[model samples]
Target: MSEEKSPFVVSASWLEDRLDDQNIRIVDAAWYLPAHNRNGRAEYEAGHIRGAVFFDQDEIADKTTGLPHSVPSPEAFAAAVGALGIAETDTIVVYDGPGLFSAPRVWWLFRIMGARKVFVLDGGLDGWKHEGRALVTVQTTPQPATFTPTYNGDAVTSFDAMRAIVDNGSVQIADARGPGRFLGTEAEPRPGMRSGHMPGALNLPAGSFASDGRLKTLAELKTLITEAGIDLDRPIVTSCGSGVTAATITLALHSLGHTDNTLYDGSWSEWGSRSDTPVTTEPTPKKDR
Candidate 1:
């Protein structure tokens, strides 16, 4: 069976055709972990899609918290996106260096902040360049626009709420880290953090949903979710190293027509770093819920 079409994603060709659309805003949302040894800003400055502005995940986050990529307040987010000349009403297209990696997080951020027409570029900049698409090294200066944000509190899971879920198993937890990290067999990329995952959290590495820097078909995603023991009928909270890749799981769920889900903003950056939260290495029994 063919995969269902996703309204939240657009093809490179689709975006290229609309590069000059007055109401469209293209964003380069590239981000990488320290272990990757790549700087998102440096890559964007070197060369990026023409007319695309860079979205600095670290700079636009809730810096008050020590956690990495923590969600910023509505006012802060509004100011940041507005300065990029992106209005909530514009048709926003976000792409990352690896196509399906960090782009989904920005897509989710816009949606939670009340942007109605945000979408991810199916083949990120990597794929675009490989296909001989156009790029420009010159920086883009956007005409500032006003953005009114309406924060969706329900879409965010608090540390306290996560603790309750871990204790009661009321919501299914999906960990987007690799199997080695999720199983505590590998050291965490972040120093001094615990290795294992949250108790009862199922491993669902973000890379599994995509191949060659592009997302897999919907049918394949459903199969992967079932194999990972995620219960689509139950509410889900997606998490990862620093709350970035977790959005890929959330995006997969949403694309599969699952709506009762949220992303843990603190993720392991907050959970594994602290001494109070519980961690486990054993695999969660499949379909126990």
Candidate 2:
């Protein structure tokens, strides 16, 4: 297996050594499902990495859509990051409570918003705490910086585009939900939503790509993607329950040098809630691409 470290992921030790660096901005981008029964903000207030600021995934999102944590507008994103004292040039490192869950969403957000030096801390705050790293209850108050956003519109797959893709199989849909949920054999966590996968959508649960809060090696990732029947040479569109864990799939794909992928921002939250979209319980048969 290839042992190459991902440029988009940084070790906890690397972050600890540069915690005091002026240009390094650490973001506690922790978020949890209601089912997890943990408050992200309250946890941050209890203690966080020194100099780390909390990034509210729900608040920083596009509020007009009423979708949970939808992508925010470029202008809104700029203001949000700027207020958090992040600049376009800073080396932004994002981490969540469970390592690889929601942090990659923020990493994807920054990259799509034109922040080039963005990264996700390997083995999140939990791992950091396990290593006996010191945390502070005191919140960081940084001087606001100017962040000009150059949003990449192509990085986001819209509802209309997703519809077209589903109808025509123009792009392979890689879903990050669990096998039970994807196969319609389990109940959805959200009420009033239909159960099942999209027609021709491939199951690539986000949890399979990481272990112990760290993403697996490139060779392992490749093996998993292929095992899921995803063709790396073709275009891919990632989706999850609410578009959060989908970025984990995106991160894994990008780490393997696959660039032709877009995230379906609304994900199953929108697709399963609506009556217009087609839903299926039949799984796609595995075959060589």
Candidate 3:
């Protein structure tokens, strides 16, 4: 299959003009780490973009896996989104508290689940509010719509698949954890988690792709990515603490027209927890020209 050809990022003004459109769906995919001490659902209940539906990541996940926010099954995904009154044919736009943070995970999920017009709001809620856009505390309940999901097998990488990829050195591993975590110089935010990255994995901290909490332009993203030692031409798989920030890299790469990529669903949260899996605290940095 060829790479996705359309741009998936939209501006706040663009959305404001279509806020009342029936065929469009806005999703609040905001989430926070435990350290942030914020409640995503509660925040959503209080106020969000005028007509957005909240997508709770923790609730709509595969519970069988002893991991956080593992990808949900196709049936579960369809039901979850369908209940939110989101249809497969609607123009879906996802946004988080800060721009380009956790929303890309939702964007990636929608694409894999067969939503063709899914996009991410460029500035997130922060950007929307900055533009003096009005937000209301009132809630909306749309008519429940039916959605059928067709899973794209290539979008996600299993733990076993990650191991094999590491062993084969065919697909490049881009760890979105910060440099300190990747180099074992800083402690992991999640307690009991190990330091360092997967063997042969390169560091591409998710935060670098944005400035002042908004995603950078295409040129800025290209520079940030290339400087981190990733070759856009190579096949890559992105991973992070809990598979959340990994989608940031996935989004950046996709925005750059590099579609030969996949996310490790069971990222470091799963990989670092497994005893049989090999991990190291040392870094052998790859020099990117």
Better of 1 and 3 by lDDT: 1
lDDT of each: 0.92, 0.93, 0.87
Best by lDDT: 2
List clashing residue pairs in candidate 2: none
Candidate 2, residue 273: the lDDT equals 94
TM-score of each: 0.98, 0.98, 0.94
Alpha-carbon RMSD of each model:
0.9, 1.1, 3.1
Regions more than 4 Å wrong, model 2: none
Worst 10 residues of 1 by lDDT: 1-10
Using alpha carbons, what is the TM-score of model 2?
0.98
True-structure Cα RMSD, model 1 = 0.9
**For residues 1-289, what per-residue lDDT tens digits would candidate 3 score against the true structure?**
1322227788888899999888999999999987778777788888788889999999999989989999999999999999999988889999998877899999999999999999999888878888899888888786899988889978999998999998888888899988888888888877777778788888899988877566777788887788778888899999999999999999888888999999999998888777778787776477521
Instruction: Give the local distance difference test score of model 2.
Output: 0.93
lDDT (Cα, tens digit) per residue for candidate 1, span 1-289: 4766566888899989988899999999999987888888999999999999999999999998899889999999999999999999999999999888899999999999999999999879999999999999999999999999988989999999999999999999999999999999999998989999998999999999888787888888889998899888889999999999999999999998999999999999999999999999999888665
